[model samples]
Target chain A: MTATTTVLISDRPIDPDRLAADFRKQTAGSGAIAAFVGQTRAEAGAVKALALEHYAGFTEDAIAAIVDEAVSRWPLHAVSIAHRIGRMAPGDPIVFVAAAADHRRAAFEAVDFLMDYLKSEAPFWKQEVSDAGSRWIEPTDRDRQDIRRWRSAPHSGEQ
Target chain B: MTTRILFFGQLRETAGRAETAVDLPPSVATRSALIDWLAKDDPALHAALNQDSVRLCIDKKVVLAEATFSAPNEIAFLPPFSGG
Candidate 1:
């Protein structure tokens, strides 16, 4: 059963180890725990930093909706998602998604589902800053495709 | 009816401001109507909203293009999300 759910959006860098440990404590008896840490790409000089912006009231609500949907669909014991807002330097932690469940597959898939939606569904905007200048980053075609799969019924072997 | 409209990210940059409380004229009631009304005065907002990349959230949830929303409170126009 899904026990604790954490959705956080902040300007500070995320501590993946702490987040995982907290979730592990919350889901003590859980069989499997899955964690993912998404960091800013270090593309040498190509991208210097990433600036993130989010709507104040709506960002939290949107993430809550995503978490609720995931909990409903899976038997997750606990889940935590943390994303950074404002500026983050290259290789800084950008996002963290973790799930603990009685089984490995459920924990793994729930994190994936939450992340795909977090990327395409949540209300966040990013700009890449480099020597050339700064420009707003848009979701790529793959991101759109990734989120669409969640709309249809969950089938086996779906990417 | 009054709607507190919000612009985030690139939408804010394009609109040249953060948010506005617009009193919807009887002629303009829905989100689409509001966009059309602003487009007349804000060419950049008009251009930005015209792109399919933009999205609308009434209150806090995303609304489909065809959804009808009564004027109550908040409405946010968003650029493509690139969170994580």
Candidate 2:
């Protein structure tokens, strides 16, 4: 079956459970499904809000490219990604990724691979608003390291 | 011809605006030349754009600084991405 991919960038709130359910239905015959949801942290009251900004057309295209890479690397049946733009309060969902494949390992690894790339390389700017002030966040060294691991790993097609 | 230049993330903050349009001169043809030209009046913007971490996009597609094009509709200066 041809892989079904859904990518969305929204200014409003995202419903992770709803997206997961919808994705589940889309990949019904797949043997496994892996999903991840990321949320803004309150940071123990230091953070008041988190703001995400993206280039209208370019950002979506960049993310879709990453999704395509993931599909090419794994034997995925479907993938869905949704990210929130604009201001979000603490506890709000920031992003969601789900992958379905014929086996558990493929589904699990695809979701992990997608998130690592999204955190470090996706075309979105993130800022943490706090009582002190707002500051733009950059990818940490660990984030870069996480993504680098996949660079050396052999892809399914390459093997 | 007029080219639209964009700044994102901290670059946008440094530029004090998200985008601007500039009419290019013949000398300001390459991406590096364009940055120098744009920064002629704004030192801080020049420094921000000069950072190695900053990437250039021409007409919505990321390209190397050495890449050259004529009368491209858009050019964006992007800082390192921090999403998810």
Candidate 3:
């Protein structure tokens, strides 16, 4: 069967538990499932909210491309990505990615790979609103380094 | 022809607006030329856009500053991404 890929960008809150359950149902026959959820950090009351902005169609396309790359690189059954845009308060879910595969290794690696690319390459801009002030956030040097690891090592199933 | 220019993230803050339409002069044909033209009147915008980390996209596709086309419909200035 052809691998299924789902990508969604929501302005509303994302329920990570619901997303995981739905992915598990969709990829029922897959032997392993791996998932990751990112949440807005409270920063000890210093940060009040996070505002995320995306280039309507462009952001989704960028994420879909990353999903396609992940599917190609791994022996996967399905992949699902959900990201939240607009203003979000602390403790809110920011993003979720789940991958299903026949083995544990493929499932684990795909989620990791998807996140690294999303952090640095996706076209979403982020701003943090804090008690002191608001400031735009960009990918750190560590983020760049995280993504570089994939480029330096060739995956087994790479085209 | 009027080309729509979009600024995102810190560039949006620096530009003071999300988007603007500019009618290109004859000399402002290339992407680099367009940046120079836009930066001519605004020092803050020039400084923000000239940063090495900023990227240019033509019609939603990232392109080099030297890339040239006539009367493109849209051009966007994107700062580095910070998504999760």
Candidate 4:
């Protein structure tokens, strides 16, 4: 198989359709395609506004590693991820991840896996400013609980 | 020797700078040692580094809290990432 492309971007205001097109162009098989777009919400609870920050060089490298891990762990033809940085207003686009694979299962699983890893593994930080004042948002135990699910495989009864 | 230590998000805001040079004690050979040394110098970083919720990376690679560090390296302390 030829070498596929992996797009990892960190910028202000992410474009979901552009991310989808990137994945589509990278895959030749065109059997199945899956995409996930995560946008900023009006209410994240306790968060009046979120300011995301990352190390200039280190952020990109950390994200690239996550993308590489996704490519290795799954049979994906193409994968792309984009995230926004700086002071972001509510309801703005935050992140995008799209993958194309030979089957829907692979595509879906790959996207899910990438999202999980990105949430817990990537090196980005957000500070929530609100009526309570700006505080560095820390990942709650629930976030870890969600991450733990990926470590174990649930039987699908494929027999 | 000095190493470029980076801080992100709240840590940067608390420290009031994105990156700064921290003096390394002579026997500080690992990443873990560097954190210990830094905490001794900067109270804000000391508290942030000691928090279980925080993480560290060296030259863009996540390393264990006790990982070794070399001279002229890039180090960063950041809260957990939730990009997706």
Candidate 5:
């Protein structure tokens, strides 16, 4: 198949290798592949658990939009993204992203681009439960700037 | 025009539901205008909506502050994303 495919889900646990392999097969002719995995750290600071909330229908659509944008902006063969929802412990896997392309540059750049958009643009909210209290998490200015950098950064498909 | 407004994350929990219908004032024409009108109704929504961490999408596409939406549109307001 010459079409790009995507997998977006809000499951409890995500299979990292499987996700990577799926993208690999989809982009079989690709010479390079890139995958980024975000896992829960043991130290959530004062938080015990994090409750991830998302708009059921809108979440998938928004993520799909991001994938489509990446596919258009890069010569990507395939991509996969999966995010976890519900109450998660500190050590749980938070997110997974994999991209494949015919060249290392496109695969690497596309994966980074997708991650930047996903971080600031996706519709997932994190609520931290601590011994003292619980509250909603907000993105720091750092996160915003990280995403902003991508707008001006060079990419494989662009001059 | 009838539009659907969706809330996500803690905002949805705080608002007690995921989606709502926002009847814009006759003069309201853009997304920012709709936000301004809604904020006037609830101070919390006003504050929450103003935070930079919130993202706005019109008809399933992310939109800037000055974007406009017509009838039967779907607009979503969500908190900062933590997706990988």
Candidate 6:
């Protein structure tokens, strides 16, 4: 099967619907599709905007490797990820992940893994532009905890 | 031998510059040594580099402080990521 594996980083907005349609077209035989969109929140009016910075050539490579690892451990028919850079307002979409597989379980698991990997491991930094003045932010402790779920079982189940 | 060191986010703010091309002295060979050498004059940068939260990337891939490469390579230092 000719499946598409896309990992994209853009300074422009990402279209989740368009990406979903493209993945569906590429993984024609897949019966299940799972998608996740990460949006910026207002943080109780603390944040006016969020500026994201990436290590250029490295950000894509790091994300691609994470995608490769996911495909290697899952029976995925297609996988697509998009991360937006630059300034984004609250309630704006910041990231998207989509995966397709023959079964719902595989698609769900792959998308879950993809999100954790992107949040913790990808080489992108974020700064909150606020009335308190801008400050760079780090992954929350919860993010680190979420990522740990995949460590002990990197390849526990596969088809 | 020279290498281009890049800084991002908070680290960039601390360094007050985006990139610095440094000519490596013979005494400064490894990543660890390079930091110590660069930190000689700048206390803020020294503190920042010595911070456990500092992360490094060589030629765009995350690597350990022990990782080594030839001159003219690109190296980046960044703080903890907050990407979603």
The lDDT of each candidate is 0.84, 0.92, 0.90, 0.71, 0.75, 0.84
Measured against the true structure, the TM-scores of the candidates, in listed sequence, are 0.90, 0.96, 0.96, 0.84, 0.77, 0.92
> Model 2, retained fraction of real contacts?
0.84
Best first by DockQ, ranked: 2, 3, 6, 1, 4, 5
Candidate 5, B22-62: lDDT as tens digits: 76666776766777886677878777777765777777777
> What digit string (tens of lDDT, one per residue) describes model 4 on residues A1-159?
332656555556777887677677667666888888876665646556777776677767777776676677667777777777777777777788787777788778777877777776666787777887877766667777766776765321111
Q: Where is model 2 chain A poorest over a 10-residue stretch in terms of lDDT?
A: A150-159
Q: lDDT (0-100) at residue B52 of candidate 1?
A: 69
Ranking the candidates on TM-score from highest down gives: 2, 3, 6, 1, 4, 5
Give the alpha carbon lDDT tens digit for every residue of A10-79 in model 6. 9998887787788778878889999999999899998999999888777888888888888888888889
Give the least accurate 10-residue stretch of model 1 chain A, judged by summed lDDT. Answer: A150-159
Best by lDDT: 2
The worst-scoring run of ten residues by lDDT in candidate 5 chain B lies at B65-74
What local lDDT does model 1 show for residue A151? 81
lDDT of 1: 0.84
The DockQ-derived docking category for candidate 4 is medium
Runs with alpha carbons beyond 4 Å of true place in candidate 2: A156-159
Ranking by lDDT: 2, 3, 6, 1, 5, 4
**DockQ per model, Cα:** 0.78, 0.89, 0.86, 0.68, 0.55, 0.83
The residue pairs found clashing in candidate 2 are: none
Candidates 3 and 6, the one with greater lDDT: 3
- Residues B2-77 of candidate 2: C-alpha lDDT, one tens digit per residue: 8889999999999999999988787777777988999989999888999889999989999987888788888899
